[model samples]
Target chain A: MFLKNRNIWLLAPAVLLIGICFLFPVSWLLQRSVSEPVWGLQNYITIFSKTIYLGVLWNTVAIAGVTTLLCALIGFPVAYSMAHSSPWIRKVLIFSVLIPFWTSILVRSFAWLVILQRGGILNDFLAGIGLIAEPLDLVYNRFGVLLGMVQVLLPFMVFPLFSVITRIDGSYFSAATNLGATPIRAFFRVYLPLCLPGLATGAMLVFIISLGYFITPALLGGRGDIMIAQLIFERIDEFGDWPLASALAIVLLVGTGLLFVLVNALIKIRGRGI
Target chain B: MTKTTPKGGLNRRTFLKTSLCASASLAALSIGTRGAFAAVDLSGREMVFASWGGSYQAAQETAYCNPFTKATGATVIQDGPMNGSKLRTMVEGGQPIWDVVDVTDTFLAANEELFEDLDFNIVDASPLDQAYVHAKGIGCIIWSYNIAFNTDVVGENAPQSWADVFDVEKFPGKRALRDRAYPMLEIALMADGVAPEDLYPLDVDRAFAKLDTIKDHVIWYTSNSAAQQLFVDGEVGTGVLLNGRTFDVNKKGAPVDLTWNQNIRSIDYLVIPKGAPNAEVAQHFMNATVDADNQALMANTLAYAPCNPAAFAGVEESVLPWLATTPENAEKGFLIDAEYWRDNLAALTERWTEWKLT
Candidate 1:
């Protein structure tokens, strides 16, 4: 009993911290969703009834989904290569990925603005090389938002996948080779299946963070790219509508919770298959 | 949930109760400390003056705070980029940190309950424009939103009117407008041929219809910095920008020029938040700020016209045309209806969001 309870005792500080800081404030905010401006579920009803609110909700989800997929597609190869590379090469790759994490997101977003704006370096370079006659509408659009989000979030996906991949035993690949399988075949048949857990974890982390993104989307996106976080800020700052903002927050919280459950279920099913 | 308890020691319930009491007393002690300070005489007290930062705050320090501090022997500290939500939070919490805040007149009108009514004897606002001064706020500065364009990009052909801004075929480049509902609706109405005097009780449908023509061509800038960047980076050919920001950029040798034609004038007011620790000192600060000479100095420095009409008399002859309140300039611009915005901001903002998304 003592041994089993020791770990629980160790977790008590974290539990207490979360309870006081995160859970308390969030629950208070959730309570305000129903109680402010009047008592009822009217805030929720209003959210569902208005197409604009629903549209931004859908926009947030869609952007998150695409950003997750792009990050996974780009990060998997980079993380995989880093895991399999020589030690010096691996060190260089890790350093490059972690460098962006050290810089502020605001600075990076503005850097992207400079690179992607019309008559900016990218456009000027492309035009100079005779690649295109006109500067493409790149920065203040969905493309810019996705580019900035993926760049910022790629490190999140890479680190987790690298940690998991490094843990896989090297003998597995050797064993597969001995069984007359090619390197590619061995990777798909063995390494890929083993990496699923890490892939899921990284994808889930990136998706959740992207859902709450405000600054990058606001700075890089055009008129049609309003996200849920920006909408909540507008509600609070422009209208002083705390109740409605709280309600929107609650919706995001519940949606994130649902996504967590769904991802957990899928991971469990995959775990069973493995 | 149980922890190992020492023999003959306090139970969990007793421990929790004692700790709760201790924390409650700690909070009370903090509030008590603040109350003790507030009960003292106003002389030598320190007060916070909150306003939009940058050259604006620097100008205030020179024109308002410095003189007030010299006369009253009170220390004035600067804070903030004038956020409405923070003001509401501070006032509602009953421990407002800001003694005097510079906020849009519309914001003061909307959140009147959070402000203290001004006493005319304490805060002599007689030098200010009577139309802008209210019981809850004193007029601080007047600025206009004008058509600002990059001179390097547009050359000799600058946009002269809102009609030119909306006519993409004539100008043929991206334009930026403030993301907020105000002034944009007014600009749209003017572009659609509605006279300035008839703009109040805005025809929302007509404005939105006119906006649709240039909606695709328009990029939205939510802040002054963003609007400035839009022009400096050559991302937009023209944008609606605050007169002060435009002036600052032009002074910095950025190829930006402003057209005073049909600009929209906005007034910022100095208001005291309710439950301020140094409300009386803040009132004196307000009184000192509105003196004609101080107003003129601030106007000269920031390029935002002073609220005191008499300040114009002291202003440099070369600067008069640039002042938003100058007779020639004022006639070319329409005053934004603060009352209309205070009442309809929420509904209009909702529609603005919907329209932006579309």
Candidate 2:
């Protein structure tokens, strides 16, 4: 009935625009993944048959998981502090965290390359103080990937946590304290539980984003830390094997989507309990 | 898709190259007839040329783009770091946006059928010597990859050869090499005493074996940006570098110096997509890029030398030494066997992967 009363043609241009722009290309990519026109299943077949593809997938998941965990570990405390800090302090903290997000992620990844390179500023400082004989392997390795990924994805965690934490009534913390709970107990019991949804959402966003990350790992990661996006990029660009690259891309998309759904389902279950 | 014969495939490769040359020259002749295309006012037609976007963007605009508009009249667009992935998308997507593309030497033969036969007719090949390719216009010019060193780091006494790069005991500090294996293997072999000319028909196993000798000392950086930055930061004393990036870094005050003593060169052809809307225009644009004055301007801008041997005429003698195409450098530099690299990289990449991690 609402559709009957509406001017549907108003939505036609935009709907057609999106469908033509996005859906068709995405469908074509997926189609290539499964059936390379004549070479049906060859692309998908190659992915499973090759150990390198499997290694890449594992590296993607491991890097994403570790980065997500690290973002949570680091972000939660900052969010907690900001949620309780003066409004001015909260604004300042949020602004500072949000600043890196404004710059391109590729630029930020290169910055990490500068900081973590062997004989880089960090290593130079360490060696200057007689900390070690040789500058350690810092960039072009797993450690550099983590440092870059976490830096790029940190705001995604911190922002959402701040939103959830900000909504909690101070009265709940006061009431728990009035009931003879310790300040720490009252703070955690009242504040942290309220922030779980945002925390999960932040973690899920960071995880999904990191799962498809290409640049940071490509630039920073050593041989073992190669990610799926880089594999897809190479398959298409380097090897010119479009069908296999498309297949790898579709698998990555499906995997990321499934993980997002799973995380959302968990969030929903926790939402009900809350 | 690979098969080797009883003293195999070399003859077939030669035959294919010859046939390709004949057909390309024929097409180039017909397109060379300027009056046939003179009436087709290109003012309304849009063209996009993909090149490595940087100072190249400026050089291309002034050299090819503005002059093309002034001469024949057309809208020109530029894109770049062209590879097969981007080409596949443009072609297979059925929306061929680019009329011309400047691809690396490696991509030329690998995606063989995707490109339109270059018209020798329209493209002014005068600047290119007969010896340019053993055959001209089959492929023309592509930017080269060379090892750039920090002059301040090396000081007055610099390493002349790849051997100096790997001589940690002699020219000591930290050393950097490109993370990519192509030049790495070649340099490693050279460092380990393989003759420059004997470097290809590459001995992959021997190259990797030599790479192993310097494994602990090599701090490999992947990106050219990072490779340049490492020198900028004074992180590593020396590294293998891209020619254009080295110049850019030196301009940015990184105190870097480059040696073409044993550089590997890859030739990129000016070719069109099979379905390019403006194939004739693309060929003409190629000529504009190769003109002596334009070539000199492009060299001054990007430091990538034009393949047109004659284009160097107008360039000053003082600046001639730094140009990659200068005989002093070009004679010494080996033209990269891109076909060999195209075929072997994946296999060597697999081995390199295992070697690095293991």
TM-score of chain A of 1: 0.93
Please state the Cα-based DockQ of model 2 relative to the true two-chain complex. 0.34
Give the proportion of true interface contacts each model preserves, from 0 to 1.
Answer: 0.64, 0.38
Task: Return the top candidate by lDDT.
Answer: 1
Global lDDT of model 1:
0.83
TM-scores of the candidates in the order shown? 0.91, 0.80
Top model number, TM-score: 1
TM-score, chain B only, every model?
0.85, 0.82
Model 2, C-alpha of B143: deviation from truth (Å): 3.8
lDDT of 2 at B220: 71
Across residues A72-144, which tens digit of lDDT does each residue of candidate 1 receive?
Answer: 9999999989999999999999999888888898899888988888878999999999999999889888999
Query: For each candidate, what's the DockQ?
Result: 0.46, 0.34
Per-residue alpha-carbon lDDT of candidate 1 for residues B185-206, written as tens digits (9 for 90 to 100)? 9999998998889999999999
Tens-digit lDDT track for model 2 on B23-58? 322211121121122223566766778766776666
Q: What is the lDDT of residue A231 in candidate 2?
A: 70
Candidate 1 stretches greater than 4 Å from native: A1-3, A170-189, B1-42
Error of 2 at B55 (Å): 0.6
Itemize residue pairs with steric clashes in candidate 1. Answer: none
